[model samples]
Target chain A: MSEKPYVSVENISKWYPYKGDKLINHEKKFIKANDDINLSIQKGEILGVIGESGCGKSTLGKLLTRLETPTAGDCLINGVSTKELIKNDMKAFRRSVQIIFQNPFDTFTPRDTIEQILLRPLKNHNIGNSKEERRKLCIERLEEGGLVPGEDIMKRYPHELSGGQLQRISIIRAMLLDPEFIVADEPVSMLDVSVRAEIINMLLDLAKLHNTAVMFISHDIALTRYISDNIAVMYLGKVVEYGKADEVVNNPGHPYTKALISNCASIDPDDEREEISITGEPPTPLDPGPGCYFAPRCFMACEKCLKEYPDKKNLSDTHWITCMNAE
Target chain B: MKNNRLTIAAQAVKSNRQLMAGCIGVLALLVLMIAAPLISTEDPTIYGPDVLNGLGENGHILGTNHLGQDVYSMIIYGVRTSVKVAVISAMISGILGVLIGGAAGFLGGKVDVIISEIINVFMMLPTFFLILLIVALFGNSLTNVMIVIGITTWPGNAKLMRAQALSLRERVFVKSAEAMGETKRQILFKYIIPNGIFPVIANTTLGMANAILTEAGLSFLGLGDPSIISWGQMIYAGKQYITSAWWICAFSGIAIIIAVLIFYMLGDGLNKVMDPRYNKRRA
Candidate 1:
């Protein structure tokens, strides 16, 4: 990891108010999708975000990619606040950051051929001299993404391609733009297990080649740990723990994090340990209280943990946890 | 199961009796409009040798009006008038509706609310009466009537286009385009409009039929352009002669009904073909 961060998320929060019922009688309740998130990634560094479903991992990715702006606070990319960026600069900002959506089928326009899809970003950004030049460039990019004989693929529509191949094309599009940052929100989760690694490896290769800052969001801790230098575990909408991938994996801090890692079954039958299960779903995000969100499900929930949000207690120079009763 | 879109659409149109009937009617009228001068070189406004000549007398196919005008020539010119009003007025309304509704749908926020409110206000207004008031206020030339009907009757199209735009704007492809650094206007024009245009087209076909009906209604009230001939004007002129020369109003009324029916069928055909679930279930 570099000493300087390329992207710094500073105390960001995203709250969505309940529709048609706001301020009618009682206090206006807002769903805290992301509550005061703070993390950073250096150029060429991958930050893996692991969380249960609807724990704000995808929301974090969206916020990083500026798909949805932070309701409060700002993200700094090379000393420039994302919130402060103006109208003309938004296009450039968008060009710099790209997101790979989870659903491969929905990523590409069904109406557009692969060539049209590939050439669209290029044409929008004025990357080519002419239509013929853009077409050639598209074919080149497709081949580079390992869809060999890209010429044949150009005529095929999106539905004609497999999930894995479509994902590679999406990655190719991101690479074609040469974005500075990327948010792969469960990029491989929707694909067959056999092709997941191939897709992830393609993304990893692209990030390494372009030196792009990547925030890989997924529910699989091991996958994120394998691909990311640093990993942040989220519970509900709060980041419960963040540290080096090895440290988090070897010395899991938050109780929620410990249960999460231990739950991933292994190949060896002899490799056995007592399971620390936090059963059932997390609490609703509507009007979240002023305590740790994980406290309700935490195995080591102290009385203090129920009433107060914990500060980030440093476990090491490179590791931290947001639990007051962390072991 | 493996048919491409164009072939599927063609098959759908072919099988749909409503759409085929409408297409034939509209196409026949279009053909007649194109061949207007060749169909009858004789001036529509010119008086014939005899007044109130019945059908087949002196080579008059539909006979002559009380003014000694060739009923056949007047009907030809009336087709020209009705077709022109329908086409031009529908075009104008469709364009306006697409633009306004598309902008409102894609740019949702204050702009959306404002545009939607405007649409609502326009929707609430009685369009026929609105047209009537405008025509009554402004002198009723063919151009004036066409423009008035075009401008007033756009709210239906706008509402439809707005609904389509609302759905299309949320599509992943649209978001992908937005993330590609395309400007709001560019996305609105290139992506949202094109995808959402099918519904607008189906609705506007129906609107074309309505435009003809509206024009006929205007002319039937004796508010038609004095210089040109129309089916409604022919009907009005034939009203007093109903006891004797019933051919005058009857034939023009029939023309008006035929023109309106065909366009309605065409529009209905388009709707069925465009319905995503319709053919998918068939296959």
Candidate 2:
């Protein structure tokens, strides 16, 4: 809605040090979780981040939610730098940027009831009036997340619910806080395939209704395309390609992106046979060099792609692609 | 999230007749302790005509001790003493256990090794012998008994908690909470304590039973606190007139058995209540 972005991630990176010693010395190696990544999301926009496991997609979600501080660069919220924020500001940031984790079951503490679980965040923010008001608010939020007859669900424990129901409850918990930005890190990956679309559609509807920006992270490109307006393709902790969701999925620019689309079952099954498969598994984040992170696995990688990291090239007024040749 | 585990435990108490019976038995004893003077017809310390009337031409229903004090009244008084010793001692052990165990488990390396060594030393000491030595040295006071039991019982619970903490420290939620910028105090109190409360509860109930039984054995051996009329003391007093009045000791022994059974059952109920895996299956 505004010219300026709601949240901007500027050259942020996270490197996890792996201590080699089993003893107390703390000698270690390092694994780069995210590497010099710059991205931005405008107010009320949906940005989907697609990547395989261990590519730091979840790490990105964690950083945005302030669950983990980025080792480098700054994550700015509405032009206010996160680094300068005091304890109260950090709490405000957390309230603004919430995350729904992949495993719906493990996200909640086992000791609490559904009502108690919902009440915790409300209590943390000091929201609502009395116990009765909080209970009424929780039921309303659950209904907003598509769980009608929320009162019945509220009285039952998490284990008593099915996987799909649990996920809806998880979404209700996130929605109750009315966060401005949500990082849904594969929120439906743990659910039965039949219910995944329903959950995704509910999320999209909720986002639209509340004008909340969402960074929908998933390994399933098809699902990402179904929900996202813009898509960022990540490989081995690097965003190899990113643009308008349709363009990136249909007229893909990067070799890694092409390979991924071709491999999808939604794409022509015959495309899988003719498509160039990148050689070897993706390189580990540890010992990653200066060149393109995907060059090792890129079928079209040249000496130039190997020698230098790619920059984000403007594909259209609204689309940006990250690849050397895309320029 | 009303823990499914708690619901399952409630169901177990409702459905299992034996468990319900044991629980009720314990509840009744607790009520009796609180209403001791009201419930008992006689002053438990009063001396009367060699009061060993078994089948009754007397006011005493469960007969009387060598001192002619009602065995029933003495058993009622003992409930307060035995329950007090067990609960206080178990609490001391539980608190100390979680602290030492949690610290050692959470902060591994040398701390774990040192705690393990301390636990091993305590564990190696013969249980009955250690209790006897401490009780003998301290001179048979109720406070002395509680102190000995409390200090000695913790090593086992500490070792248990250490192992539990070590495992819990690695759970995804713990790591996630740490990554969420939660303080160490928050993690330990909010996460570790709630996750680890089951063992402490179970151990405490079991400890109460252990304490009651031990006190009974000590009193039966004439090593009881001379000023207090306990179940074990009643049994000891009855032993002197065993041939003429088997009723006194039998009644006291029955009291001891019921008390121990109740506590053990409470522990079992709690174990069922606190375990989630079982709840999942049942639910």
Task: Please report the candidate that would top TM-score against the real structure.
Answer: 1
Model 2 lDDT tens row, A1-327:
247888899988998887666497655667999887888898789999998789999999888776677889888888988777525564566567777778877766566568876776677666798888999999987887777788987877666778788888777777777888888889999899899888888888888888999999999988889788889988777777778899898888887888888777754444534556667777788858678888777777788988878777877765666678764
Candidate 1, residues A59-141: lDDT per residue as tens digits? 88888777787899788898788766634487688889898889888887777789888887888888889999999988887
lDDT of 2 by residue, B76-109 (tens): 8888988887788888888888888888887788
Name the lDDT of candidate 1.
0.86
The alpha-carbon deviation from the true structure for residue B125 of candidate 1, after best TM-score superposition, in angstroms, is 2.1
What proportion of the true contacts does each candidate reproduce?
0.52, 0.12
lDDT of 1 by residue, B1-283 (tens): 2368768667777878898888778778988888877896467788767799898888888888898888777777788899899899999999999999898888889988998898889888988888888888898899989998888877788888888888888777787777787788888887888878898899888888999998889888988887888999999888999989989988888889888888888998899878888778778
- The window of 10 residues in a row where model 2 chain A has the poorest summed lDDT is A266-275
Provide backbone clash counts, one per model: 0, 5
C-alpha displacement of A218 in model 1, angstroms?
0.9
lDDT score of residue A74 within candidate 1: 80
List DockQ, one per candidate, in order: 0.59, 0.21
Candidate 2 chain B worst ten-residue window by lDDT:
B174-183
All candidates' chain B TM-scores are: 0.94, 0.90
Model 2 spans with C-alpha error above 4 angstroms = A1-4, A19-27, A267-273, A288-296, A301-327, B1-7, B10-28, B31-42, B49-73, B95-196, B213-226, B231-258, B265-283
